[model samples]
Target: GLLPAMALLARTLALLAMTLAITAIKVVPLDMARDSFDDQYRGCSPAMMAVLPALHNFEFQVNPLFTQTWVKAEAEWRKRGSPVSPLASPAQAVALMAYTTKDIYKDFNAAVRVAGHSRQEYRNNFHFKTLHFLLTKQCHHVFRGVHDVRFQARRGQKVRFGQFTSTSLSKEVAQKYGTDTIFEVQTCHGVDIQAFSFYLSNQEVLIPPYETFKAVLETNDIGVALFLNLVLFFVHSLDHLGFPKLLPLSPHWKVSSVSPGLNVIVHSSGSFTIL
Candidate 1:
């Protein structure tokens, strides 16, 4: 199992390097990723302005996650008295909103434009945004801004050391079980901690205003949304079963109840096909 994990990790790095090797072969243009950003409005936060535009560039980083930083973040989180693991996810978005304090609404207007909400109370409390700033606090949290894909993948990597014995289980059984196969596809995640305003209207240019600071995210919502939708849609459209149900459990990972197949895509479109 470790072998597969390690090999997969290697493949990821290789894919990234490959992309950088031949950037000219890109499929989607930049316009889709950076939609809605106007040229005249620069991102209000200096940190965001620098990082958001370069989401595709792995080399550039205004913030990086390292041991020292994560230690500081955990400490600060403790200081803030945040829950051990925040109860926030797409499914529990309502719960996340309930946990939202009044302070997150400081820049209500900025949030409304990007998100379609203006009211302070029901306004969108981006788990992605709040989590972003929380990590960037003075405490020097280890996690970098949401803009870094490598940083996020590192955070998501799990090295479990318990018994992971797989029963000959079933080449037949596994294949049969997947009869209900619901999903199979690639996944890519990119985070830009600084969600800058390429073009902010006169009203939004004002900081501390509701318009200037849109709610922050725990990760890059735009990228995640795009990545998941792209992959899920691609896989689900072909399968008769509707999209895989979101596992009632596991907020940190994407869960799809799909039949297992030879094709599997890991983080950043790094995939392996058994056939």
Candidate 2:
């Protein structure tokens, strides 16, 4: 018995060690995590970066548990007549737009323009024109007049079209035409594109009209529905077993009908004393 107990304890310790190891592997070092966040925030749109402090505060408000903490904190703060507002500032509105619209502009260059015919034919045909026109329209709409879009494309960047082969003539080409365009024609096949435009859209862009929020709320609804169903099932099971009716019965009575040789006694507080 002692040996078995020792083995069980060893197995539990091994499991705990394994769990801790896995957790440690998943957890990023604090400095590295902060640095990564800082990089992302820096890479974000200028409008978004302007109200970084407000965005940080707004993030806390969106969280239900965090909002509760904020409310309690505010209540305590207000006791000294120093009330704090939970609303995002006017500058944060622009930040919110930038934050939400970034997804639309993500991976702009990686977008593959599939053609029905050969590459040359596709370029010559109206299909290329139509595609370019659409892209130009989107660029104009999203960026407005902002033209300082800069991106660093590597020499051998892998994309859907194929590997991006860099050329020395990229600067000359950018100068010949204009950097106002979304992509600069670096070579016959490969193009150099702005990286900032790839991940930043217009300030006018708001989240897709509550569809995303609806999906998130629906997830919570599913969990609540399942929990309620489980509670109802348990309640139904107890009711089906005639637990409520049995509670009112006298303590001296024997419940021979439900189970043979079984004695059920009801206490003064509607509790069962089964023997």
Query: lDDT per residue, candidate 1, 1-275, as tens digits?
Result: 89999999999999998666444322221111111111111232333322322221221222232222333434444454444333222212221221122222323223322331222211223212322222210111111111122111112222110110011111332232221111111121111112111111211111111111111222222322122101201111111212223332333333322122111112223221111
Q: Candidate 1 versus the native: TM-score?
A: 0.16
Worst 10 residues of 1 by lDDT: 160-169
**What's the TM-score of each model vs. the native?**
0.16, 0.16
Q: Rate the local accuracy (lDDT) of all candidates.
A: 0.23, 0.25
Candidate 2 structure lDDT: 0.25
Model 2: residues with Cα > 4 Å off, grouped in runs: 1-5, 8-25, 29-72, 80-275
- Candidate 1's C-alpha runs over 4 A off are 1-116, 119-128, 132-185, 191-229, 232-275
Instruction: Report how far off residue 158 is in candidate 1 (Å).
Output: 30
Tell me the deviation in Å of residue 139 in model 1: 30
* Model 2, backbone clash pairs (residues 3+ apart or across chains), number: 1
